[model samples]
Target chain A: MAEIITVEHPEDPRLGDYTSLTDVELRRRREPAEGLFIAEGEKVVRRALAAGYRMRSMLLTPKWVEVMRDLIEAADAPVYQVDPALAEAVTGYHVHRGALASMQRKPLPDAAAVLAGAQRVAVMESVNDHTNIGAIFRSAAALGMDAVLLSPDCADPLYRRSVKVSMGAVFSVPYARLDPWPASLETLRQAGFQVLALTPSAQAEPIDRVAPHRMPRAALLLGAEGDGLSHRALAAADRLVRIPMAHDVDSLNVGAAAAVAFYAVAHGRPGE
Target chain B: MAEIITVEHPEDPRLGDYTSLTDVELRRRREPAEGLFIAEGEKVVRRALAAGYRMRSMLLTPKWVEVMRDLIEAADAPVYQVDPALAEAVTGYHVHRGALASMQRKPLPDAAAVLAGAQRVAVMESVNDHTNIGAIFRSAAALGMDAVLLSPDCADPLYRRSVKVSMGAVFSVPYARLDPWPASLETLRQAGFQVLALTPSAQAEPIDRVAPHRMPRAALLLGAEGDGLSHRALAAADRLVRIPMAHDVDSLNVGAAAAVAFYAVAHGRPGE
Candidate 1:
C-alpha cells in the first residue's frame, strides 16, 4: 500500500518537508505557503490520518517502522526510512518520538460555516504563542466547545509545535480565521450568540455569575497570555466576564484560563 | 544593605548556585540538596522575596542592576553582576530574563500541618514534571486552593523551572510531601476532608454533579499526565470524580485538570 524508500543523505530534496523544523520562523512561513503541516510521534501522526488529513509523506526510523506498520500499510504516501542521526541533523533536534508525517492542510472554513453548527465557541485574539494555541485547542475540543474563531494574527494551529502540544487536537476542532477581528465579532451576535469577552479587569462581572452555561448560544472571547484583549476587542463584546481569581494572582496562564472558561461555559449543559 | 560584586570569571565559586541550569537532572538533585531554589526574572524574584524567602545571592545582567536597585539596597545577600555572555556561559543558556536569585528553601510543613487550616486542597501523586507542578501551583493559588499536598515522588515545587513557571506562586502557596503517599492520604480523611480522586474512568461521577464547591472541606487528588492515578491511589480515595470531557478526548493535561478541579472545589465559597 506504500513505498518504503531508504534515505541516507540529509540534503535529499525529497525530505524538504522535514528539514529545519526547529527553525520556527522558517517553518512558520513555509508550512502555510506549501499547504502542509508536520505531525510528530505515533499518536499524533495516526490522529492526523484518522481526521482525514492527506499524508504527503512520512519519515520514520527503523524501530518505528514496525510500530507504525498498520499506518504504513494503509498509506498511499511514500515512507522514508532514515537513521536517527540523519533525522536529527535534518530536523535540527532529536526526533524522540521516532516518527513524523507531513499532512496536507485543508483550507479552513469561513467563520460563518464554522459557527453554523456550533452552540459554544471560543474566540481568540492575537494568541500567537504556538504552545498556548495548541493547549487551548486541546481544551476547547475536550470541553465540547463547538468551534474556534481566530483573529488573523493568531498563530497557525497546524504549526508543528502547536499540533504536537495539542496532541493532534488541531485536527479535531473545526476553526476559522476572522480576517477583520473585532468587526467580524458582529457576525457572532447576528448568529444569535452572545459574545462575552474574558478579561482580568476588576470591573468585569465574575464569569460564574454570568452563567455562560445557561446561555443558549455563547461565544467567549480570549486574548494572549500577558497583554489580554485589545481595547476594541473588549468594546465589541456584549459583556465583560472575568474568572474570579484569589491570592492576588495577576491572572492564570492563557491555557489554564481557557480551560477553566471552557469548562464554565460547558458546565450544566445536557450531555451530547 | 547588600554587597555589589562584579564577577567576570565563569568558573567563579560564588556562581556555583547558578551553574548548569539547563541540565535538569543535575539541577533537580542539586537545588534540593543545597536547600535553595532559583527565582528567575524580576517579577518572580520580587515575589519570592515578598513571600519571605531569604535570598542567598542574586545574578543580574547590567541592565537588571538598575531595575532591581531597590531590592539590592534592601537585601543583605551578595549581588553578582555579570555580562550577558558570562551569564550565558555559567547557566548554559541565554539569561533572557536578565535576573536570577538563589533563595533559601524553608523546611516544608508536614502534610498534617498544611491540612490544619485548609478547606480546599490539591493532592498530587507522582506528578514529576516541573512545568506541570508549577502550573498546578499557579492555578491552585489563583483559584484559592488553600494548600497542596504531594506524594513523596512529586517534583520539588522550589526547583528553578517550577519557580519560574509558577510565576512564584509556588512561594505563595504552601505545600508538603506525604511521605507514605496513599497511606498518608488517610490523614486528610481524619481531618474531616473528603478525598476525591480525579480520574477519566467511565465509572467516575462527573465533577460538576459531585458539586465539590458545595462540600465543606474537599481535597482533590491529581496524578501525572499519562498514567493517571495509580490503581492503589484511586482505591484509597473516598470518592472518584472526573471532569466531564467531550469529543472523546483521552484527558486534559494535568495542569488544566487541576485548574478546573480547583475552580470547582472553590466555587461559590466565601471570599478568603
Candidate 2:
C-alpha cells in the first residue's frame, strides 16, 4: 500500500519529477538521466504498471485519487494528492486527465539481444520526433513487427508526449538502440536478417514486389521524415524498397510510411 | 498583377480572412460559410494555386515577399505584407511559415462525380479530426487511392491545419461529401466497387487473405479513431476486412490504418 501525502506548494521538492513538465528540453535530458519516465493519464499509468515498470511515484488531483484507487493500493510508491490548480502550477499544463505516474526506466537491452529472437524488426534512423517515434511504435506493435531497433539519434520513446501518443505502446514493444549506426547495422546481417532500407527513391524496388513477409528474417529500415535514410545507412542495407506511390504525391509522412512498410514486411507472415 | 498592400494593424479588414486561425470552431464555420480556405506555408500555397484554387488574398512576412516574388507577380489577388508579430496577432499563433493564403473553395464535386472515373476510392465515416483527415489524404494520394468520399460529418480537408499537415495533398486528391451516409454508400456498389469496411473485429477476414489488391474496383471504408464504423456503416459494406495485428494490440491509429488499407486496396492495380 502507498502513503498519501497532500502537496500544496508548486516548488515542493517531493514534486520535483513533475515540475517543468512542459519544458521539453529540460525534461528530455532530466528524465533519461534520472532514469524515470512519466506516464500521464489513467490509461498510460495503468499500462506502465501492467508492463512491469516500477512506479517511482504518482501525482493525482483529488478526483483522480479515487479513480486510481486500485493502482494506489497495488503500488509500493508514494501518492501525492494535489489540487487541480496546484497540479497545473507544478506541471506547467492543465492536468486534463488528472493522473500521472513517474515510472523507472529499465536499461535498454542490447541490439543483439533484442534481435536474437526476432524475425521481423524495424530499424529507425534519426527519427527524433517524439510523436513520430510513438506513432511508429504503435504501428509496429499493431502490424506485427517482432521488435524495433533505433539509431542512436532517435528520440526517447518514453518521453511523456511519446507515451501518450502511443497510448503506452512504448511499453508493449521491446526496442533497443543501435550505436555506431550504419556500421552497427551489420549486427542484424550477422544475425541472418536481410536488412531492407525503405526509401522514396525511384531506384528502389517496390516493397510489395520484394515480398518481405515471405522472408524468414527481415529488418526494415526507415529514416527521418524529410531527409530520409542517410547515404551510409542506405548503403548498409541489403536492398532498397519503396511503397508504390501514385498521382505524383511526394511521400507519406514518416508515421504513415512506417505503418505501410510494417504491414507489408511483417504482417501475415507464413506460419504465424 | 497582384496589388501589394502594407498592413500595419492586425485587425485590418483585409486580414479578417486569416484571423483566429487557432479557433477551430470559428474557422470551421466561417471558412466554409465564406467559401474560402487557408493554405499555409510556401509549398502548400503553391500547391493550392497549382490545383486551381483561386487565391482570395495572401499574407506574407517581409522576408517571404522576395522569396514569393513570382507568385506575387502572377496572382491577381491582393498580397498583404505583415510583420511576424502582426501575423501572430491575427492568427493566434506564431506564423513560423511566414506565409498564408486564403483560397476560394470551389463547390465540392458531388459523390457520383468524384466516383465516375475512379477504380479505387476511400470512404471515410465521421473522421472529424483535421490532422487525421490530412494524414489520410496524404496517404491516399501517395498510395494510389483514386479519390476520397467523406461522410457528411467529416472535417473539411481544406482547413488550414489539414492543408499544412497534408503538404497540400488535399488539393491534389479530389474528394466529395456523401450526404445521407450509409445510404449514399450504395452509390459505390452501383458503380461496381466492392466496398470493404476496415475494422479490428474478430469477425473480419485478415485483409491480406482477402487480397483487396486483386479486386478490380474496390472502395475501402474507414471510420474515426475511437469508435470505428457505425453499425449501419459496417452493415452497408460488402465485406469487413482487417489488417492482421500482433502482440494483442487493440488497433492502429486511423491515419496508420488508412495508409495500410489504401496500399492494400489501391497500390499497383492491374493495368495501371
Candidate 3:
C-alpha cells in the first residue's frame, strides 16, 4: 500500500521531480538524467501504470486522492496530497486533470535488439518535434509496425507533451536510438531489411509502386517537417519513395505523412 | 499600385481586425461577425490571396515588406507598416512570422455545390478541434480528396491556428457546412455519393473493403476525436467503415484517421 503524506510546501525537496513542468529545456535535461518521467492527468497515469512503468512517487490534490485511491494503494510508493494552489505552484500550471506521477524510466533497448524481430520499422532522422514524435508512434503502434529507430537528434518520446498527444502509445511501441547517424542504415541493411527513404522528390518512386509490405523485411526512413530527408540520409537508403499526391500540394506534414506511410507499409503484409 | 502607410500607434482603429489575435474566443466571435479571418505569416497570406480571397488589409514588420513587395503591389489593399514591438503590443504576442493578413472570408458555397463536382469528399461531424480540422484539410488536399463538408458544430476552418497548421492547404481545398446535422447527409446521397461513416465499432467494415475509390461518387464521414460519430449520424451513413488497426488499439485521433482514411479512399481511384 502507498504511504499517504500531506505536503503543504511548494518547495518540498521530495516533490522536486514535479516542479517547473512547463520548462521544456529544464525537464528535457532533468528527467532523463534523473531516470524519471512525469505522467500527468488521470488517464495518462493509469495508462503508464498499465504499461508496467513503476511509480517513483505521485502528487495529488485532495480531490484526486480518492480518484486515485486504487492507484495509490497499488503503487506502494509515496503519495503526497497537496492543496490545489500548492499543486499549481509546484507544476507551474493548473493540475486540472488530477494526479501527476513521476515514473521510473526503463533503460532503452539496443537498436540491434529492437531491429532483430522487426519486419516493418520506421527510422526517423532529426524529427525533434515532440508532438510529431508522439503522433508517429501512435500510428506506428496502431498500424502493426514492429519497432522504431530514432536518430540521436530526435526528440524524447517520453516528453510530457509527447506522452499526452500519443494517448500513452509512447509506452507501448518499443523504440531505440541509432547513433552514428546515417551509418546506422548499414545496421538495418545488414539485418536483411530493405531500407527505403520517404521523400517528395520527383525522382522517387510512388509508395504504392514500391510495395514495401511485399518485402520480407522493410524499414522506412523519415525526416523533419520542413527540410525532409538530408542528402546523406537519402544516400544511405536502398530506395526512395513518394506518396502519390494529387494536384501540386508540396507535401504532407511529417505526422500526417507518417500515418499514411505506416498504413501503406503495413496494409499489404502477408497473412490475414 | 498598393498604398503603404506607417502606423506606430498600437491603438490605431485600422488595426482593429488584427488586435488580440491570441484571444481565441474573442477572435472566434469577432472574425466571423466582422466578415474577416486572420492569416498569419507570409506563406499562408500568399496562399489566401492565391486562392482568390480578397485581402482587406495587411500588417507587416519592416523585414517582410520587401519579401511580400510583389504581392502588395498586386493586391491594391491597405498595407500597414509596424515595427516588431508595436506589432507585439497590438497582437498580444510576438509577431515572429513577420506578417498577418486580414482576409475577406468568401461566402461558403452550398453543401450541394461542393458535393456536386466532388468524386472523393470528406464530411466531418462535430470535429471541433481546430488543429484536427486543419490537419484533415491538409491530408484531404494532398491525397486528392476533392472537397470537404463540415457539420454545424465543427470548428471554423479559417481560424488562425488552423490556417497555420494546414500550411495554407485550407485555401486549396473547397469546403462547406452541412447544417441540420444528420439530415443534411441526405444531400450527399442525393448527389450520388456512397456516404461511409468512419467509426471504431468492431461491427464497422474495414475501410479497404469499402473501396470508396471504385464508387462513382463517395464522401467519407468522420467524427470528433474520442466520442466518435453520433448515433443518428451513424444511422444515416450508407455504410459504416473503419481503418483496421492492430495491437488492440481502440481508435486513432481524427486527424491521423482522416489522413489514413483519405489515402485509403483516394488510393485506387481512376487515373495515374
C-alpha lDDT of all candidate models, in order: 0.92, 0.91, 0.89
lDDT of 2: 0.91
Candidate 2 regions exceeding 4 Å error are A268-272, B268-272
Q: iRMS of candidate 3, one decimal?
A: 2.9
Please provide, for model 1 over B115-231, each residue's C-alpha lDDT reduced to its tens digit, 9 standing for 90 to 100: 898999999999999999999999998999999999999998888888888988898888898879699899999999999999999899999888888888999999999999999
The per-residue C-alpha lDDT of model 3 at residue A215 equals 84
lDDT per residue, candidate 3, A126-150, as tens digits?
9999989988988888888899999
Reference contacts recovered by each candidate, as fractions? 0.64, 0.75, 0.60
- lDDT at B211 for candidate 2? 78
Candidate 1, residues A72-182, lDDT tens digits: the string is: 899999999999999999999999999999999998999999999789999999999999999999999889999999999999999988998898889898999997878
| Model 1, runs deviating above 4 Å | A269-272, B269-272
lDDT for each residue of candidate 3 in B1-272, tens digit (9 for 90 to 100): 67999998999999998999989999889998889999999889988998999999999999999999998899788999999999999999999998999999889999988877789999999988898899899888899999999999999999999988888888999999988988989999899999999998889998877776678888999999889999999999999998889956646778889998998888762232
Ranking by lDDT: 1, 2, 3
| Per-candidate alpha-carbon RMSD to the true structure | 2.2, 1.9, 2.0
Taken in order, the candidates have interface RMSDs of 2.7, 2.8, 2.9
Best by DockQ: 2
Model 1's CAPRI class is: medium
- Per-residue lDDT of A1-272 in model 2, one digit per residue for the tens? 89999999999999999998999999999999999999999999999999999999999999998999998898899999999999999999999999999899999999999988899999999999999999999998888888999999999999999998888889988999998878999999999999999999989999877888889999999999999999999999999999888846789999999999998887653333
What's the best-to-worst order under TM-score?
Answer: 2, 1, 3
